[model samples]
Target: MHRVAVLLLAPVVGFDATIAPTLFGTAAGGDGEPLYEVTTCAVEPGPVASTNGFAIVPTAGPEALDTADTVVIPGTRYPPARTGRGVEDAVAAAFARIRPGARVVSICTGAFVLAAVGRLDGRTVTTHWKYADTLRELYPAVRVDENVLFVDDGDVLTSAGLAAGIDLCLHIIRCDHGVQVATAVARHCVVPPWREGGQAQFIDRQVPAGDHAATAATRAWALAHLTEELTVHTLAEHAHMSLRTFNRRFRAETGEAPGSWIRQRRIDRARELLESRDIPVDEVARLSGLGTGGNLRHHLRRGMGMSPSSYRKVYQGA
Candidate 1:
């Protein structure tokens, strides 16, 4: 059986801590045997206070890391005030015990701990999108792609928030088992088996209900005419500004390129069409501004690592 050893830090998010075990343990092989054996290990064997004021007593300590097939770090409240001082020492000792080829994972702000160890150096990684900017600022060596739900750089995987942890665990199950097994685990958990990491984190935003919404109107305008095959030139024209000026201010506010933002909007539209209607694939291409079925397939595979039909099957939510 595959062994998943999770390192439980002080103040751990309890839900994220249980994700791997609950998801992986539910999967079965052809012989009907469980595929993974999950163990929760802490720096110490005794009780530790959780963020929610609950207490946890893990089964094993750092020594168990020496034999783990996989090592996961679940999110916890970050340091400076909320955390105990032993965090650094405990985590360091645990890191030292992990052997090679053992996969490493981080859920939510646990990316901070992984970053602290420098294991994520020069790797494409992400945390909660709200904290993405701060994580990038703190760990300059990390590539820091903030838009996706998670970044899977082979052995090292990092996810965004509590729910995204479920996604990553299911992904691991799929990689270790297959789509069929992962689907079963997701059904057990009552979650979508797969979601495009490229899917927008959130869209709805609220102002103070007083200040004149500037970018809000601009964003709406961009979404209306996605199929027009426009550029920053057309966008700047709508916003009534020169190209150079628009580019600077747009990046300052949205933190993404004009082209990328448009493409993402188009993809979201494509997903909506794919899920809600029986529209043919080529129509999906045209409506989503991807131009043709072949182009749509290419973008879907590159951005999400899945075919359109497969994506619809899981996330259609219909």
Candidate 2:
């Protein structure tokens, strides 16, 4: 089994720290056996208080990092204003014990620890969108892109806040196993197999709810009918609203215009098909409403910096 060690720093974000073990530990192999052996560790190997006024006693100490195939550092609220100035002695020692070639992952502000240790230098990474500016200000060498939910820079991976960690975990499982296993895990966890877009889609927005949740049904219909010819006017008619009102409401509810949202959804669908299915690029494009292979290539390059074939090769593990 893959050994995963979660390093719990003081004032850790309870939700962020537990997600990996909970998700990864529950992940099963084809024969219905656990795939990962997850262990919680700390610098001192004792009860560590969380930011939520609770304490969790870890199972091991820093030495666990030495044997772990993957070392995960969850978000923590450290002292001195949580700035990425320098690594603590204990933290540095733990990092050192992480055997060379072992994957290192950070969730949310846990990127701060990696940044402090100079592990993120010259690497593209991301943290919580709220802390993206701070990370940039502190580490000028790191290419910090706050738009995506996570950055998987080979051995080193960093995810945005909270739930983005789940996405990262799912992506890792997909990378390690395959789409089937990851999709099964997502279904068991009662979450979507994949989110629609990058972290940018989740930026704070005042979305209407209940009866005032205008355009929600139309959006759902559009998602289900991605291959259909969908324009702003069509969506407006589906929502029983004027084109101008629909556009305004779409921006208000989704934090983007209707065309942009539809484009992203199409791109997302295309990516899903590319990763999970063995279909021709032209067929995938037609099914995703991109119309043609050239259109699909253009959008994939612009949105993901990769062609459909390249994305399939990388993500499908083929």
Q: How many clashing residue pairs appear in each of the predictions shown?
A: 0, 0
Give a tens-digit lDDT track for model 2, residues 1-318: 799999999899999988898888878875688878999999995799999889989999998998999898899987632675587788888888989899999999999888888899999998988989998998888888888788888899999899989988887876676566677789988986665324352646554655444888998999999999899999999998899888977776665788878987787678778977899999999999889999999998986687888888876632
What local lDDT score does residue 254 receive in model 1, on the 0 to 100 scale? 60
Per-residue error at 66 for model 2, in Å? 3.0
List where candidate 2 sits over 4 angstroms from the true fold. Answer: 143-148, 201-213, 242-318
lDDT on C-alpha atoms for all candidate structures: 0.76, 0.84
Best by TM-score: 2
Best-fitting candidate, measured by lDDT? 2
After superposition, which runs of candidate 1 have C-alpha atoms over 4 Å from their true positions?
A: 78-87, 205-318
Supply candidate 1's per-residue lDDT for 311: 73
Residue 90 local lDDT, model 1? 60
